[model samples]
Target chain A: MNNYWSAIVNNLDPYVPGEQTKLSNVIKLNTNENPYGPSYKVLDAIKNSCNNQLRLYPDPESISLRDQIASLYNLNIDNIFVGNGSDEVLAQSFLAFFQKEKPIIFPDITYSFYKTYCQLFNIAYKTIPLDEYFNIKISDYLPKIHKNYIGGIIFPNPNAPTGINLELTDVEKIISSNKNIVVVIDEAYVDFGSTSAVSLINKYDNLLIVQTFSKSRSLAGLRIGFAIGNKNLINGLIRVKNSFNSYPVDKLASIGAIAAFQDIDYFNFTCNSIIKLRNNLINDMINLGFEVLPSKANFIFAKHNKYDAKIIYEKLKDNNILVRHFNKDRINQYLRISIGIEEHLSQLIYILNKIVNN
Target chain B: MNNYWSAIVNNLDPYVPGEQTKLSNVIKLNTNENPYGPSYKVLDAIKNSCNNQLRLYPDPESISLRDQIASLYNLNIDNIFVGNGSDEVLAQSFLAFFQKEKPIIFPDITYSFYKTYCQLFNIAYKTIPLDEYFNIKISDYLPKIHKNYIGGIIFPNPNAPTGINLELTDVEKIISSNKNIVVVIDEAYVDFGSTSAVSLINKYDNLLIVQTFSKSRSLAGLRIGFAIGNKNLINGLIRVKNSFNSYPVDKLASIGAIAAFQDIDYFNFTCNSIIKLRNNLINDMINLGFEVLPSKANFIFAKHNKYDAKIIYEKLKDNNILVRHFNKDRINQYLRISIGIEEHLSQLIYILNKIVNN
Candidate 1:
């Protein structure tokens, strides 16, 4: 550590994102990216926006894009807030609503970035353990479980690594239970099949639903994400945002995200296809002696009955296949694989069989 | 204000950026945007990078873009860091280095965002008043002025609103005086004509130089900016960035920025023409009885001695021309005008001439 480093920096254990290896011809399933390319409409809109208008700044409010999101959710413009990515929205949320006199609560096996954000913002936090089957138990979040105060709550709806989705009813239970604190539902993987918490945003004033174009919208490289919440929660997020970075969303990203929402037909078709592929992949893994979690997102978390998970991950990597293996507690034996197209899945299965047999 | 708002949000006076008015015919001069569009190569690069790769996440490391910047400055890759925009870099810098036991110091009439950042981060600050002619006196930063405490220092080169450049020697003096404190030179407008303190980074571990592609490369809409400094300082910034947002810059932005640097001849031509136009605009303002500052940036700060600044601003707005007029102490009577192209300038002069004659 450098002597000049701040106490915050020194204390931060920065989040390690999924590997973005640039290897060509690799069947990359590690990052949970959509197997398909962005819609033709998204590509066309971004291409059209690459003009001289780029000389000026974008609308800091991202009005048109917010309008598109609002209309999609049947919410008003005041309910939406946009940013560089959902990660940024989460970061700002930690700064805006999570830092208080009390500790916040999140799932121990949820998105790892939540803990990283707590460290960065100096927010005290307690991680409630997920169930043995890797599902988020809403009862664990009830205030009666702990006498200590809670400033806020946040977690991915269809949680990462485990890819297990909490039912919307259960989600509402947590929000209602946390009557005095904000409950952030990170629906980054919601579009895959899980029900959105967005519909409940109007009922729960403290509920904030964070989503991304990175996942279902197929715009990770464009870096756009947004929040849907009541006006006050959105305002708090926006206030932290304005103080951090005025123009978080760029011009091309704005147009591309707006177009992504506009082509509702394309979005639905893509999500349906991914869900179909996920089910097929799960069937194949189960037949191959793996126990896969009941996944509602675009990925599957599984462990083979015989083979070591890390060894299998390495063997697949040697054959030019990439899947994520977490070396963390309670889940080190599990492998999280993203659902690619049919051909990619066939190739993955073909390789996995060879590695297991060998 | 919302009752759910955090204490930080409640205390913050969010920065008001110059408007991105949707009106087409308005000759906008408020925000200091480049008069010309980015080099044609930027468009081609972004368009080419806009395809299927968008499905995957961008490089959180932003390696190639940092490489391009390092090569440009003839520094090692460790000396550089890239972010969404200089604004984000500045925000991270505030978190990384500036919050300390002592209150940081900046010019009273500098970029207004500095104070907003201070409030957002809860960092105490002391603003040294600019002299009668709106120039920062280097000696004012001497330890003798604030004997007991000083955290850090930052100000725009060719200082904002005044468009006055500080000599490199004076910049060195400030860094030298604050031996242990980080000195941030926000050289956002440096590409026009002012000397950048980037070269002095090797000598001072406490120095962090921030630059943006918005002004010179005409990429405000693209939102790309970078910082150069010692490896330790860069490491602190990186730790903060990774904790906050894994990837701030996107694929299109990375390629667009890299291509902008590759076409140096085009960049030089654009900057020279703007500098030439700024000289012409200064001459015109003086002849029209406006007291203009000696500008080293792509903008001028001037006031017509005969007319109230607010009235002139309102009159220009009536003519569908927009310029920034800050209603603050010492500089309320001035209009900070961005230098547009010859055609835009001609339109501006025609309108201003009419306003003055009337």
Candidate 2:
């Protein structure tokens, strides 16, 4: 728009993230955030790191944190890379492995940030449309294999906005058949229900699994995420990261993430509670004549055939409650609602029933 | 090199930062770290922020922290851009402003990261070598300017490794003459003893000043930095940032940085102490038959005409005292020693006397 801007800057249509409303009383279900707080041990670890030692730079390699992650996932330190968030880890992956002579392929309806990253990096991409049932057809990806091309795939285990998970066997088949390409399984919400592909990483050198602490770990504000992959692929990402920024994780973030891994009991308890709440919420919605999809994430995607989705989103907003509604074409009719605490979900269902009856 | 990595990754020779040793008794002087600890209020603020609220994501826009930075610099909020560190800020600037038809220009021996960033972004650059005395010759930059060439310019104000600062008038002359090209002044160590160019931000639209809390505010472990420039330029960076990662600064880092700005007395006192110790150390080195450069930053660059620089460095390291020595061609004779506390410097001087006398 301006003379001082770069050519790519003017062409970029940046992704608009879900609204983070600051109103204290609003029932915020817009972003898929965990309702429970982080474990007490996470707070203590952060406190322990915030002493007088903050004057010096943190470990540039993030060795201790990486070692902890490697142990938790049963992978070596050489097979893992950490960043400020999963988004950053994805951005580095795109630059490291996705840019090729031919276009990469991904589902048409997917995380919006992936397209935005392609635009920023000038990577050519082709959008393969999902089937009528909103499921990714694996056959569509097989045809795009070419000599000059590189494959970069990222679909949430329980995909975002739609909250439908692909079976772990299907994922394994895709990686095995397309041995020449790289397949990334984003497990941001996998802790809720879906199976993780992390266990299959050793079998497939082209498989890269991304996970975050924002959702199930309940440390979204701390900004930590990681990628588990083959040692060579992990080394490529480290090269890109070292060339870009040395210290991506701060003192508090590193300490809090390490402690989050240490407290396995708290993590299991909180994630289990969310899954239970999600199933109950789905039952309530279906009984009320809402078309809810099969969900395995911390959120559910649903629509009322009689009520317009935009109208429902606005009404909820007016009542000081927030839910996600997309303006994009194929998914605009649906609403993505996050699973909150018991009291918050009860309030949402009661209000929804009244609105539908009226 | 791996078969899956992009072609660009294979060509990159990434920058290697100075070592961060974990020895307890060593007087660490390799990287230019602040000798004193961060403010007590910064530690308190970080502790206060590590709570249940971490279950939610931080403000992606970082509005409050930007407001604090704007208020301190007497600039509008739109003119400020923040990143994980000055290194990231500089990298973004290279992608946003320096990828023009002509190559960018920088000192051949300035911040080593500048060359590394150029390679990472695939930007063409021509290094304007410093004069024989290791000073940035303004005349060299003026003569090389042409219409279809010269994207921008960047160098540390108090040039790194040399610890010398350019006059404000000389910098302004460069800005006025090269009105079409962007000029970035990296003032990472300016707060130690030199003046700042933040006051001239309103006068020149093409000028961008980058600074960090790592050197001045003593919060390096927290990873925070900012760029002050025209609003249009800042917005260009925001587009790139949004495409990459939304929340580069985490919740605790934002809160800790704000507290750092609030404690003006602590910041000023620490900087003053470092300045005094630096001057005393320089005098003592000269008295001991070493040639020390006139420094405006926290570190001193010195070498002895009688002894081998590498020998002296190895001797100091053997005694558990660390300092930075570059193996590069031009600066192989000098050692960059950070100014620590008075007692640390006294010990260093005693060891130096023994080495020289022996």
**DockQ, each predicted model:** 0.83, 0.81
Residue A200 in candidate 1, Cα distance off native in Å: 1.1
Q: How far is candidate 1 from the true structure (C-alpha RMSD, Å)?
A: 1.1
Give residue A158's lDDT in candidate 1 (0 to 100): 93
Clashing pairs in 2: none
What are the per-residue Cα lDDT tens digits for candidate 2 across B273-321?
A: 9998999999999998899988999999999979888999999999888
DockQ, candidate 1, comes to 0.83
Per DockQ, the best of the predicted structures is 1
Fraction of native Cα-Cα interface contacts (under 8 Å, chains A and B) also present in model 1: 0.79
Docking class of 2: high
